[model samples]
Target: MALSIRQKRVRRISGDPVDGVVVQGPVDGLATGTPLYSVAVQGTIDGRTTCRPRGWRFGTWNVGTLTGRSLEVVEELQRRMVDVAALQEVRWKGEGTRFVGAKGGRYKLWWKGDDGTGGVGVMVREELLEQ
Candidate 1:
């Protein structure tokens, strides 16, 4: 299934309709380097909105050997509210299957490794796909 996000513009105080301008774009970061397009629609200045110190967190970590720590690592990810993660030196040989987490969470794991030494993969929270 393919999912996308489209936002609608808010109304002005004077009850006037604002002009909406949409910008589309794509980014390539996969091993195949396939492009994924996204659209952003321009809207009125929602002056009422404000910024907060809290924000989304994403990063990469070296799991060393994720053999017996799959659940542990995933649970830690939940604790940190990690939206995206890139794993390195997983120490797992061969390409592993999708990572399943609590509450029906999931991830895709790909590795080109040698003898459980060095492996790399990007772990995307399944919810990220909805965006």
Candidate 2:
């Protein structure tokens, strides 16, 4: 005997109209247990409505310690154009935000840890700080 499996179909629901925009229907070919939907944004740029997609690079790493190698880590991340990163095992005591890297390429490090042995941190490119 052969086993048969059935996949659940995701139903598309119409969202309430906002700013004269009505979002309806689901994207095709992305059927899964959870429903996935996309939104179309119409923004005015100098009296023009434009729709564009923005992208960013992300990374994750378990740095042994950030005591003396913080700058090095920032340099590597910049070289790879990583917009945001989730770091583990930072090994830095206390929680605070600090600037790292050289003049041209800089990143803000937000870290939190009780002791100096285990911690987590997030590094974001300086250019995207305001956003």
Candidate 3:
């Protein structure tokens, strides 16, 4: 979605003593209390403002069982450039975080299950962990 705000309004809302702009307000078509921020760009045209495109790629899949194909899942997600993924029927016991895949394609898998029958999991790219 695109949001149009005046330069003066941007300055007023971003009252932080820091350098970047802190955009906090009701975004149209978005849920209430959604967080937003703005980063200063290096270059811009005389009469036009530049907007950097930023978004997350999410996906969902029913893997039946994650018993021994966790690495394969991670590799596939990486190949597709998926930032986050939700998995069903993980068939794993307990709940914890596991790091899978090799360097440059690493991912963190978080799973929760009562027995070894049905479970759910979420995998996130390792780089996104710091953010």
Q: Which candidate is the best by lDDT?
A: 3
**Reference-based lDDT, residue 86, model 2:** 79
TM-scores, in order shown? 0.52, 0.62, 0.61
lDDT (Cα, tens digit) per residue for candidate 1, span 26-131: 3222222223333343344464333232233455677777777777767766665665667777787777557557656665455557788888866777776666
Ranking by lDDT: 3, 2, 1
Quote model 1's TM-score.
Answer: 0.52
lDDT-best of 2 and 3: 3
Report the candidate with higher lDDT, 1 versus 2: 2
Superposed Cα RMSD, model 2: 9.7
- Scored by TM-score, the top model is 2
Clashing pairs in 2: none
For model 3, which pairs clash? Answer: none
The TM-score ranking, best first, is 2, 3, 1
Greater TM-score among 1 and 2 belongs to: 2
Worst 10 residues of 2 by lDDT: 27-36
Where does candidate 1 clash, by residue pair? none
